[model samples]
Structures are given as structure tokens and as C-alpha cells.
Target chain A: MTLHRIRGGPRLSVDNDRCERFGTCEWEAPGLFELGRDGRLRYRRRVSDEDAERAAAAARCCPMQAIVVRGVPG
Target chain B: MSDGDRIVIAGAGVAGLRAAERLRELGFDGELVLIGDEPRRPYHRPSVSKQLITGAARPVDMTLKSYTELDARWRLGTRATHLDTTQHVVHLPGGEELWYDGLVVATGVVPRHLPGSPRHDPRVRVLRTAEDAAAVRRALAASNKAAVVIGGGLIGCEFAASMRQMGRDVTLVGHARAPLYRFGPRIAASVTELHRQHRAGLAMNTAVRHWISTKETFGLHLTNNQLVVASCVVLAIGSVPAVDWLRGSGLTLDDGVLCEPTLFATGAEDVVVAGDVARWPNLRFDDEPRRVEHWLNAVESGRAAAENLLAGRGQARPFTPLPRAWSSLYEVRLQTIGLPALAEDTVRLADGVTGFVRAGELVGACGWDRPKAMLYWTAELDRRLPAPATTPAPARWSGPEARPAVGTAP
Candidate 1:
């Protein structure tokens, strides 16, 4: 459950156990998260500051609440 | 509005919580109050029928992480008894009345119960709250007899699937010819196959005619003259909008609180509606007002309602969301976008995708275990929808003059 943090921006992590693959995160932050054709979740571990808001929105939109964004700037 | 102004939100579910968050995100510094009938803070309700029943997640895991961050007065375990639109007052039980400059109705829905069902019977249960899920779990653990779930809707199906995963003999009973009939024949067939592969019994197109309870087990006599004996029975029939308290409130109530395209309560400028309790016509589709009881609708409508309330009616934009919902059963993941029930014809597309057509146009699409197909179809459906209306930018406020004078008529 360690919060991953990138040097310049926030980092994203999905709890594989809790993630139900709803694909809602992909809709909110397409570049950061995606639902592959194989029914698996594909996401970047770190995102630039410009994508922080969208990443946070994706985390909030997740029904499972499995997505976590760390080191978000105020 | 200044700090003296207040916005009282009724119902503290996901929609209500989202509305409060949006208000704060828009820099609302006015007094904010949330009234919830449930004693606890908002939690993810979908888990009640799935993970909670299977011992995979607890009640604590279902709570929303953002609720604790909102700085608002929480009035939990209290129901809103009455509404005085003219006075802009919301009356609660025990003669408590609170004044509000704006209101958001997100009371959500309550599960329907079967007639002649014993309320005190521990064997019969309904899955709406965390308490209900815990009770169902205890009942299942206590009995070795088969569990009978009386419904074929998503909730019932999920419950039945969870029970099967728990290695319990389960039977799903419904009046429809097949399970998930609202999703169309292909999905229904797929769901039926899934149930069959899981070795769960299906008693579709039948209903309980008699409820016979004994010291050891309960027997459900169906209309088709079959007896289902079980240690526990769950009623997942359906739910209706929790609008009983709004009967004399002067708000238009059909199946839910009727609202304008902007999510404002009809004839009430200062009030808005959201979540499963909101019945508004989606301008992207047609003029018929309908209630979308999906999870995404709660989030989208909640934010829209809050924004419209802050921007005022003159500058508010229409809440035209493409309805979306998803359900998980066994290894199958079903995702849908738009109103599948409104389609006149359904065509099966490649890679486990289904297209819903109304008036020779693609109005909805559903993916069965095909997330990629769903993504593409969702984009295609979005392209078909009318372009979003161009509304003036929301009126941003700063300092004390962010809103009108408190108690002033709009």
C-alpha cells in the first residue's frame, strides 16, 4: 500500500485486488489509464502535473475507489 | 452568495456528497448542510450486493474517501419530513425546520418488498444497506439449506452469483421469461448461460404464490406450482424513488422529482434534483423525462445540479449525459452506454458488442466482456448525439458577493 510519487508530479496506482476493471478511469484520463482489449487495466505509474486534475477525477469516478493519486500539488 | 447564505442538501448518498464537493470546488463559502436518513456517512452502495455478500469487502472499505474532507454540517439519521417551497424551508422530524437559499434533492430510492412477507423473519432479507448485507451474510453462514433469491434484476443476479462463488446452492426466481430482459434477448441469453455454467438454478417466468415458513426452513410456492425450500430468501425485485416525504411539497412528482433540462426542479428556481430521484428529459435523446438509476448518473447529475444552482437559471446549461452503467457477474463484465431500454431493435455487433437502434439510428450500445468494443461504441454514440448547447460561462464569484443576498427571492 505504498504511495508511489514521481519527482515532478503525482503518481497513480491501482489496487489490482480492488480494481474491478470498470474502465471509468480510462474515460476520465485516457492518456493515463486504459482498459485493454484483453479486459485488463493499463495505466501509467506517474503522470505530469498537467494530468493531475484528470487523474484525480478518474480516481474519484472509479466505482471501486481502487485508483490512488499521490503527490498532487495544491 | 455570502457566508450568510446557506445551501441545504437532502440525502447524503453519492449524489448528495458529489453535489457538496462540487459546491466547494466552485468556491462556495456559504453555509452547507447535509441531511441523510442513514446514520453513517455516504458509502459505495453497489458493494452491498456483491463484495459485502461474498466476504471480499467490509462496510468500512465501501466508504467514500472524499466525504471526510468536506466541511459541512452533517445531520445524519434524520429524515426530511416536509418541504415549504414558498418559505424556502425544509422541515425535519421533531418540528425542526431549516432555512435554505438553495436545495438539492438526492434522496435516492428504497427497495420494494414483497406483499405478505414477514418483516420480523430473519430468513427473509433485502440488500440495500450495509446492515442488510451483513444480515444476509450471517443468515447464509448459519444455514446449510439452499438460498432462494426472488428477482432477476442486476442486484438479484449479483447476489446469486456471489452465493454461488461462496459454494452455496442458490436459485434465482423472476417473473420475466429470462434474466436481465431489459438488456435485450442476447444479454438475457448470455446471463442465463452464465448462471447455468455456474450451476445456479433459474426459475424465470414465475413468482411466489405462497410463503411457507417452518422452524428449520422456508418454502416458496411459485405460480408455476413449484416449491423452493431455502434457509434464506432475498427480495431483489426492484426499488422506487424515495419521494414519500415530498407528497405535499408542490414539486412535480411522477416516478421521481421532475426537473427541467438544467436539473432545476420544475417551477422552483432555487431547487435542483439529482441521482436516482431526478426525472429529467435528456435533450440528447428525446423529450420524455426518465430516471437513470445508474452510478455514473449520480455523479454527473450531482455535479450538474450543483453547477446550475450556483450559476442561476439564466446561465445554467442543460444536463445531457449519456447514461452509463455496468455490472459484474462471475467472469462476465457487462457495460452499457445510453438508454438501451428505449431501443426498438438490437443488433449484435462483432466482439461481443450489441447496438441498440431506435428510429434507424444508433441510440445505445452494450459490451459483454469487451471493454475495447464498449469504448469504441461509446465514442460512436457520443458522435451521434447532438452537439452540446453553447451556454454562457458559469458566473464565477469571489469574496462575499459570490451569491445574492440571503433569503432574497430569485
Candidate 2:
């Protein structure tokens, strides 16, 4: 098995301190990061490849530079 | 990801990231190096009010994308100093230079610093960066008596609402009459009403001419010869293209980079500029090169530049003009579609909902808790509706205003 996962993704994280919560990432990636009840943020449970790209778009579109994406464990 | 064909990008904002994503989608499998001066991943700006100021969110959780997933060399915290576009090389601030076959500069705009104020003043701030938002958020926690917002545009209005919610006495001072009067009177009214409803001070048609500095207090001198005192000041004045580094570079700069129709530098070259930094003329808007500093425009423009870089002239689709942007402030959802910047008239379809329209079609609209009305009006905008009896100024198109001798929906 290839140790490194391909371009597929199932993970996302954000540096909350740096996040202005601008919603650009959420606009770009709706299925990934859900603004919780607190209006803060949390990742959805399942993130497929297609939705992952959208999430990536939102993450890239974020102006505050506050997300970190991890693939399979390593 | 190999630098299969090394593509150089400057300014690590939304434009750069959107372009990178488009390049990958277009199957440009070469090396992608994204250079940014800010040493962080891209995040959002809209949240500075609702989440960060309310302490509902944090910056780390708000990036547009995580750095690990991007298939690019992250040259973060490095400024691209010079562009020898002719030599196909970009110089960095650290004395290192990199060669490029294609370049996209999404440098974005810099927040206009408060004029005549000491830069090191702890109470002074601008809400552009995540850090800036956090500073403003933190400042409001202690003392938010009267905040002197230097601009009365969308950002200032949105902040006024957020501060009012946070119990901060806010004063929005702008040089324009009623602020954004050109954006449509209804929108300006809606914004003004929101501030008034919250009891915040609205100082439209007013200017922060200068500041009188003292040991602990700084007084803002207004053009009306009035002095307003505040615990802190948040300057939301307009921004300018961050083109200082490109001064000596031969690239054209009429306001921002005067890009050709294809979003390229005036002279023929591999470098391309997008987002708020490039003055991209819209064909639909009479070739007026507008540098819209909105999120949607930034993403759309960035994607177009990336696609062109990947496919050159052959395979890429034409960059259609972006749809006008929308926003949410003070529980009001404001949307602008097409080009309202060139509109000569406005029509309010729903009660309190206003749109700039002309000749029986819709162009730009600002709705107050009525997105459904905006959508219906948007669908009926281009179609031929019966003409209004009046001059079509401030009349509904599909609801109640379109009836004259016929008594149809306006």
C-alpha cells in the first residue's frame, strides 16, 4: 500500500485564534466545516474526496490563514 | 507534486489559492509554489464581527484551506520583492530569486492606515487580518465607549452593527453623503437605520480630517470642526493595491495593475494579476476595469487566472464576469447581482428591499430579510415585464409596481 494518501482527503482543522470566522471557507466547503451552535466551528464526521476538494477551496479562500488538513494518520 | 512546470504565484490571498485549485483541476501537474508575505494560511474576513468579536470563533479554525493538503510549496512569510517579468524570474525579500514560466499576483489590497495618526498607538486598529480582528475583539472586551470608524462603507457598517451588539458606542464617520449613497439609497437607508436602531452614532458626510495627539488621549478633528473623543479607533478606510514593491518594475499601475482584458499586465508577459490588485475591465459594464474587493470576485477572478495559466489560450474557458457579491449584516442579507455600479435607477421589489435596475431588468439589489423576494425578482429581472407607469425608479418589477393600465405585478 502507498504510505502517502493520494489527493483524497477526510480531515480538516483550524487555528481558532487566527480565524476571524469569515465564512469564506464554509462558503467554499459547506459539507466539511459546519458552524456549530456556538457559531465557532467543527468538522463534519464524513468527508469524501469530492467534498474534501470543496473544503479545500473554502480553506484556500479563507483570508485569515487558519486551517490545517490532515490525511490518513501519517 | 513535482514542480513539473514550476508556476509562480505572488500574494497568498484567496486569489492565489483559487488560482492554484483551478490549475490542478486543469491538469497542470507541474510544481506549484505559493509565495505569501503573511506567514499563514488564508482565512476569512467576514467573521471578524459575528464570531471573533463575539468570542464565538477563533482564527486557527477559520483558514480557507489547510496547508498540509495543498500540493504546493508553501513559501510562507516571504515577500516577493521584484518581478523581472522579461527574464521570467521573481526576486524575494530574502535575496533569493526563483524562475517561473507563469505568474499570478493576487497581492490583494492593503488596509488604508488612519491618516495623521501614530502607527504605534495601541488603541488604533484596522480589521483586515486575523490578528487585527482579534485586537479589536480584545479591545472591545475592556473599553468600547466610542469607536471612530474612518470609513462608512460596508465594512464600517458591518462593524457598527457588531459593536452595537457588543455594547460599544460606535461612530461611523465617512466623507460621503449618507455613505454609499451611490450603492443605492435604500441600502444606505437600511445601513443607516441599522446603526440608528442600535443607537450607534452615524456621521455620514463627515471626515476625520486629522487627529490631535496627547499623552493619553487622541482627539479626532472632523471637517465640520467637531472633536470626537474615543477610547480606541478602528480605521476602516478604503484599501489600495499593495503595489509598492512593484514600483520599479515595468508593469503598468493606473490605480491598480492595469490588466488587459485577459487579466494580464498591460505589456505582453507571463505574469497575471487577479483579485483586488488587478483592474479587470468588465465587458458587460462598458469595459470599466473594476477592482472589486469582494470575496466572490476574488475567488472567481483567481480561478480564471489559474485556468488560463494551465491551458494557455487553447483549452481554458473564457472568464465570464463574476456575479455581484452579497453580505449579511445586522440580520439583513444584502445581495448585489450583475453590475449595479453603472446603474442609473433603482427599484424596490419587496417592502424595504431595494435593487438598482433599469429598462425593466434587475442589476443590483439589497434586501432586508427578504432573500426570497430578491430571488424572485432576480428570476424576473432579465425577462420582459410590463413597464411601470412611473419612471421605473424605486418600483417593484414582479410584485406590485409593474401594473399601469393593466394592473399586473410590479
Candidate 3:
């Protein structure tokens, strides 16, 4: 799993083995997911509570279900 | 359940490859073989139109996984010529025969081009393969001339958007006034607006009567006598199933290989089908069999088919997924759920989501740039929809076991 952190934000987990770089996550949550050059998907593990909805949408929209979110409190 | 059991999967696309992987994941320690006509490994076909064409992704980047990762025999660049159902064998073009206890037909679909058109000509291109996309990219980069897209479907509209973004003059021609005619007038109008926003020319409600080609340039003479001259021509018309190989196999072949509710091929207990080539009755739409040519359906179908292959007929659950597909063009993204093709009436909701109705019921929904609405509607539709009949005998694979409940199937 590829992990990235933003210190005081929700942690994001991306299973590199399952990620196919379709870039659907990028559209759902632009602040968290980025489609880099050569179609590499880069993401920040930590996201603010306000952006939690977008983060969850990214996870749901992913065809491969490669994205997993953690530490988002209600 | 023995290790000696062998499974042969025809086609190395997402459907075929995933079925093999799922079988392994499900503790199937059997011999697995994957065959594909394409030389390269299984890649994300969706990206070939959007990211790959725009130079945002490389050919190698489109691959779903490293071809070397699968624990199966690879037979790339080889066509499965025929299926000998009586002998449980798949005959290849070179007299190579593969015998298996289980079989999966996942040959997918082949791009449909203009009939009688000179496809070998340098100016013509199709975006089905990586090579085809690369060739178009090279052609677009080399010349500053206007490009013509011969279809008004999703693919054609997408290519027009991509090319126009690359600073090329693009003209999109289609028979309908709007690009996506099946999505009703409002959605089509929105798509028309999307292309118009990019200043791409649209010759809608017209047909290409003939092609005029010379050594220097090519032209498409429209029915209205408006000749469209261009350097490159892309046939984004659509595709047909790659089931020509299974013609005499005795399986029901309509638009694709027809399968039972459990994803098994008709009349064949050991044979299953997946991906764009498998036409099974989706439990959501009242048992109306459909063949969805989207990325997610292919993967999920393969995953379900793997379980069905192991569980056999009655023991396996049905494959009834809520159909959803998304496509992005320029800055706008369209997320659709349920059956967009069967929608007869559409109502534009206040939240930018369109409710697609058929027979006085909301059968589907599409959202344009409405991410939040897409999520809500997806869940709403899944809950509100009627459950597919459990008592009626299936078209095939009808057994003694009781049908499973909705959402619990597969």
C-alpha cells in the first residue's frame, strides 16, 4: 500500500497493486488525488474534515476500489 | 477441486485476465491459460481515448498490471479460431489445441469502422488499440490540417475535445442533432454545448455520403453537400462483439455471447463468459439481458464469473449489478447509473441530475458535473428499483435451487 500523510488530516491508503491509473479519483477529489505525467496517480494521505466527503466519493467512484480512507471522524 | 483441473480463458483483456486472477485468489490451484489476439498485456481501455490521446499517459501506463505478474500460461498474439464444444477444446489458428475443464469466453469487442472504407490508408484511424491511438497522435502532431471525426457518440465527442484542446481544428459529424442521442435531448444538448465551448465544429443531423481522397488530402462529402476536408479521419462509430470465433459453438450469440443469470454460457455447465462479450440478464432491469461495454462492468463480471465457475450452476449466485459508467470531456464529467440506453423520458432535476424514466419509473439517472448528485442517485436508484423476478425460470441454467434476494446476488 502507498501511504501519504498531511500531519493533521485524514490518512489515505492506495493499494498500488490494484490502482490502474484511470484518474477517476482525481475528478472526485482534486485536492487529494492528482494524475501526474505518464498517468501516475499521486495522492496526499491526509485530508481535512471538510474534504472528507470528496475523499469518500473518490473511494466509491474508483472502479478498482483501490483507495481507502482512514481517521475521518463524524 | 483437484489441482489437475485446468481452466482456459480466451482473450487477455480486463475480463479474461481478472477471471484468471480471481480464480487464483479464490484458492483455485489449477492450471490456467490466458489467450489474447493483442500483442501487449491487458491495459485500461478507457484511458486510451482520454489520457493516452492527449499525451497525458504513455502506452505502458495504460496496463492494469504487469503481464508477468499472473500465474498463468500466456498465449499473446494468437487467435482462438474455433471452439470444439463436444471435445472441450479451443482450436487455435496454428493447429494448437487447448483442452480445459472450465472455459471463459472474454474476447471482448472489435471496433466497427466505416463499411468499404480504406482502413489501410494512412489518413484513417481507430482508437480501439494503443497502436491506433499512437498513430493518431503522430498524425495530429505532424500535421496542422483540420481533422474529421466520423461518429457522434461518446468516443467521437471525446476525441474532438482532446484534439481541439491540442490546438487542432476539429469537425465532428454525426447523424443525430446531438452527439449522444440515446441519452435524450437535454443530455445531448449539454454534450453539444461541451464541444461548442471548445469551438469544435459540429455537423450534426447529417451523414457522410462519400469519401473524396487524393494524394495530398481527403474529404468527406456530406449528404447536404458540405465537404469536410481533413488530414486525419477517426472512425469512432462503435464496436461489435468479437464472438465470430464462437459461431458454431452452439451458444446463443446476439450482440454478444448470451449467458445465464449466473454468467454461465447457455447449455454449457463448465463454460462461463464475461466482459463486453457476455450478454446476461441484469437483475435490475426486469431480466432484460444486456451487454455493457464499460470498464467496471468487465472487472466485476469477471470477479463474479470466477465464483460461478467454481460454484457451478445452482450453487452460484446471480450477477446483478447496478450499472454505472462515467466519461470526462474537457472540464465536464458525466456519471450515469442504471440503464441509460433504455431511458425514454428525462427530467432535469434542480441539482443538475437528470432522471431517466421508462414506463413511468425512474430507471436511470445521469449527472453532468454533479458529483454529489451522482452518489445520492446511485444509492437511491438501487434501493427504489423493483427486484428482478425470482420464480420465472431463467433463459438458461435453470436449476432446482431458490433464487437469491436482491443486492445479495453475487
Candidate 4:
């Protein structure tokens, strides 16, 4: 339920406990999320408005349903 | 097309739900309807075997958030009985026919049952739906005897891991020499070793010879002359696509609904297929049409099918996706890209990395506890296989045009 806000864009968060590190989000939104070489998940706290659709697609495509992106206009 | 056109999506699983969402996201503001046999809304199915079994995640937690914003009619608990492609109608069990300008087939798959299994027996269970997981949990909690899980695929292995975490004595039985045999024998051995370290019994390369159920205990006699006794038996044997209703619908049906490269049903422009029920030539690896039953494939194909449906044949792009899947066994995480099952040889690249080769070419790669390696290999595969050529324009279909010619035979 922790929400991380971007400076002037949408907020985003990922529930680490539920995330299996599938790297699917990384595939959908490469600029926002990355699975590091050490087998860890690294993601930005927020994304710009232009990338909001990609972030939403990543959240929707996450197999674990762990990612949450808020303030993205439909 | 006008906003008054109707689009009916059969099957409300992840694929069907994704298609519906993509249709809306792509600005297809029209009449939308989703029909599914499951009584509940689409939920995350992968959790049923792991988190749901362990009570770590509830049914509500698995609900897809995208479903809330869908402005569509949902016909849950309703089975699609027949399809008349000529008249563009989907027949329901109660003689209700739904006509649509476009149709999406995403009925998904059903778990295959073990032959001669006692249907009325409470000890026997199969984990596919939420109810199945709950039943299995209840059965495990009610018994002190060891639990026998038949089949060593991803679902069975995951269930075994969850049961072990719950402090249950579990035995995993598989006909292959090791668990996850499709991922190559090395990764399978590592998984087998992980199970061994957890003190779970491994029954590999064996088939059940006899089913012995008495008043108190359930037992499985192996072909190797060993008896595995347990209070509960879970059959995790694979699944078959739920395409029974599409048999006489004039759509080519092999193991699944055969589709062209664009995911449109062969010889049909207005109908498209997606999810576990779609068999198409990936074109990323080969032209052989195959069905991929994975979580990512469902999400990817569902969106692709939806986009192609709107693009029509003239503007549609070929649907070519590299198949990917993953499984968790205890502390080990196995991830794979491309078709490992089609590999003729396997080469161990690193301590936890294995590369699959077919005809001296890398067809797939897998990583055990090495997510970074999987990502690297995924990029390599993407570079090796270029994106398929743009779909050629077939006959157009809209107002008065005849149905488009089927692109290519699957």
C-alpha cells in the first residue's frame, strides 16, 4: 500500500513480497523497471506522464499482480 | 466500424480479460460482452497452486484490477455450447444466441483428470480453480498422512513446495526421469535435488499401476511394485485446451484452434483466437504452429489478438512472440525463454545457466537461480530471430466486402 510519487507525473509502487522477479514489467516498461544482474528488481519510484501508459501496461502484464501505478489518466 | 457494433468475447480468463481491456484501451468504444463458464470474475490463476495453497494470498488478492473499469456485460457461469460462424453467432447452453461483429475465443484450458480416479472421493483433488485449492488445503489439514502429488510439472512441483513449507510429508510422482524434464535434464536434476534436500520423496520415471482406496487411506501402487500411501492424492497431470465447443464451428481445430500468423482463425477475418487455446506459427523460431500454455503468452496473445482484430488484415502485424515460462520450487527459481522442449541438445553454460540447441542453433536457454542470465539470453534470442515480415494484405472485409482470405495454412 506504500505509494511512491513522481515529481510531476503518476505515482508507482511494487509489492516486493508478491513479486517473483518475473522481469515482465521490465519488458513492458524498460525505462521504468529493470531486473539487475544480481537477480534483484530495480525500478523507478515514478514515471513521466508520457510513459504512464507503458507503466500501466506493465502493471497489467505483471503475472504476480504486484505493481501498482496511480494517477494515470485513462 | 461504428460504436454500435458488438464484440463478444467467449471465456473470461486472463486472456479474455486482457482482450477486453485492450479493446477499450485501443479506443474501440463499442458494445462489449464477455461470456465465461466460471462463475467468478477473472482472477490470477497462477496463485492457486502456490500462494493460495499456502494461505498467503486470498481469492480477493488474486482479482485482476483491470476488470473494474471494463464497460462490458459479463455472462458468468454460462457455457458456450455451439458456434455458427456463417451467421456470426455464439450459442449458449440455454438456447440464447449472441451475435457479434467480432469474436474472440479465449476459453483457456481444463485440467486433465487421471483415468479411473474416483470422482466422488474427497481425497482426490486437482488444483485448477480457487475451489480446488481450498479443497486441497482442507484435505491436507484434515489428515496427518503423507500427501501424494501425481505429475511433476510446474503446478505439481509448486504444490509440492507449498505443502512442504506447510510441514507436510509430500511425494512427487512423475513419468519423466526428473521434474521439469522439458527444461532439459540438468535443470530437472537440480530441482530434484532441491526436493531431496527438503526431504520430500521423489518418484520419477514411474506410472501408477493401481489405485487402492479403502475406508481410511488412499494408496497408489506404482508400476515399480511400490505402494505410495496417503490420505490425500492430487493429480497435477497437465491440461488440454478447452476447445470442445469449437469442434463443428468450421474453424480448424487440432489440439487447439488453429490460427493464422495474425491470430485470426484460418479462413475467417472477423474471428480471432488467443490465450492457451490459440495455436499459431510463432514465426520467431519456426513456421510450425504450436500452442503455448503460459501466463505471459496469455497476456501477450490476448492483447495482440485484440489489436489485430481492430487493425484488420491489411494493417495487421504478424503475431510472433518468444515463448517464456518460469516455476518456483522451494528456494530455486527456474526461468526459461524460447522453446526448450524442442531442443535436441543442451549445454551447460554456467553453474545455473543452460543453453538449448537445435540443429546446432540456440533455440532456447534456461537459468536456475540466475535471473540475469535469463535476461541476457532472452536478448540474444531476440537478436537472433528478427521480427516477422509485416502481414500481407488479404481480401478486406467491412461493410459489403467478402471475408478476407485465410493468410496461410497453420
- How many residue pairs clash per model? 2, 44, 1, 0
Q: Which window of 10 residues has the lowest lDDT sum in candidate 1 chain B?
A: B401-410
lDDT of 2 by residue, B148-257 (tens): 67788778877777777777787888888775566787777767777777798877777877877665556888989888877677888879899887776788887889
User: Candidate 1: misplaced stretches above 4 Å?
Assistant: A1-7, B1-4, B397-400, B403-410
Evaluated at residue B88, the lDDT of candidate 4 is 89
lDDT of 1 at B62: 86
* CA error at residue B38 for candidate 1, angstroms: 1.0
Local accuracy of candidate 3 as per-residue lDDT tens digits, A14-73: 989756665668757887997675557789887777787578667745865578777553
B1-410 in candidate 1: lDDT tens per residue?
22336899999999999998888767676788999999889899989988888988888888886621468999999999998888889999999999998899999999997888875898799989989998988888788999999899999999999989999999999999999998899999999999999999999999999999898899999999999999899999999999998888889999999999888988676899999999998999988899999988998898889888888877788899988888899988889999988899999876688899999998898888887778777888898986467677654434255553222322
Question: DockQ of candidates 1 onward, in order?
Answer: 0.38, 0.11, 0.08, 0.38
lDDT of 3 by residue, B98-155 (tens): 9988898999999997886679887799888888888888777666789999899889
User: Could you tell me the lDDT of residue B54 within candidate 3?
Assistant: 82
**Best candidate, DockQ:** 4
Which pairs clash in the backbone of model 1? B1-B402, B1-B403
The residue pairs that clash in candidate 4, if any, are none
The lDDT for every candidate, in the order shown, is 0.87, 0.67, 0.78, 0.84
Q: What is the C-alpha lDDT profile of model 4 across B266-363, one tens digit per residue?
A: 86668899999999998888789999999889988998998888777556777888877887778877788888888899998777889999999888
Q: iRMS for model 2?
A: 15.9
